[model samples]
Every structure is written in C-alpha cells, then in structure tokens.
Target: METRPLDVLNRGRDKRIVIILKNEKEITGKLQAFDIHLNMWLSDAEVSDSEVTKKYGKLLVRGDNIVCASPE
Candidate 1:
C-alpha cells in the first residue's frame, strides 16, 4: 500500500493539525478546508512563535507561506 501527502491531510480534516510557516511560526487548529495548492482554512486557530501566542476564530493560510503541516 502507498500513501500520499494529501491523503494524510485529508484524513486530518476537522482534526487538530500543526502548520509550520516559513518564518518559523507555528499554527495549530482544527482544519476546515484545503485545496490542491495547500492553501488552508482553520478554525479555533492558535499562532505561536518565540515571543507570544495569538488566537484567531478563523484563519486562512497561503500555501506559499507554509513550510509543513502535520496532524497534531
């Protein structure tokens, strides 16, 4: 059997996942939607970096800004 990156992501839908950004920021939330480009929409999002953590009711992240995204 084989698995693909998007497959993993699909399974993570509506689940908590961690997204790493190019700026080394981390965002964790329940994934709401995603596209082929990796653009994503998240709910109950928390963005964190070295200094602080911020919360968002909803978030849209560009595919270009993402380094990696994995199930948390």
Candidate 2:
C-alpha cells in the first residue's frame, strides 16, 4: 500500500517539524495542527532568518507562504 502525503503528515503531529518559507526563513517547532490547505499551527517555534533566530510560544503559518515542510 502507498501512503498519502497527509498520512505522513498526520503521523508527524505533535512532533518536531521544520518548515521553509518562501522568503527563505526556516522555522522548527512542534506540530500542533494542520488543514487540507497546509496551513499549520506550531508550538514552541524557533524561526531562523540568516544569522538571527527568534522564539515564539506559538505560531500560525499560512499555506501560501510555505515552501517546504517535514518532520525533524
């Protein structure tokens, strides 16, 4: 049997995931929620922009801005 993309993603729920944004920023966080559109909610997120890294307790990412995402 073949696994679908969402099935893989669903298995990653509540786990650490890294997301690359369109602007080239990278974010690593614990996956909280997601939808069919690929919109996501993350907890304890750390965003890395070049040499700068920032932290957020929670973050909401729009699907349109996501370049790639995978479990860490």
Give one digit per residue, the lDDT tens place, for model 2 in 29-66. Answer: 99999998899999999999989999999999898899
Candidate 2 clashing pairs, residues 3+ apart or interchain:
none
Best by TM-score: 1
Task: Please list the residue runs of candidate 1 whose C-alpha ends up more than 4 Å from where it truly belongs after superposition.
Answer: none
- List RMSD in Å for every model shown: 1.2, 1.2
In terms of lDDT, the poorest run of 10 residues in model 2 is 1-10
Q: Which pairs clash inside model 1?
A: none
lDDT of 1 by residue, 14-51 (tens): 99999999999999999999998999999999999999
lDDT value for model 1 = 0.92
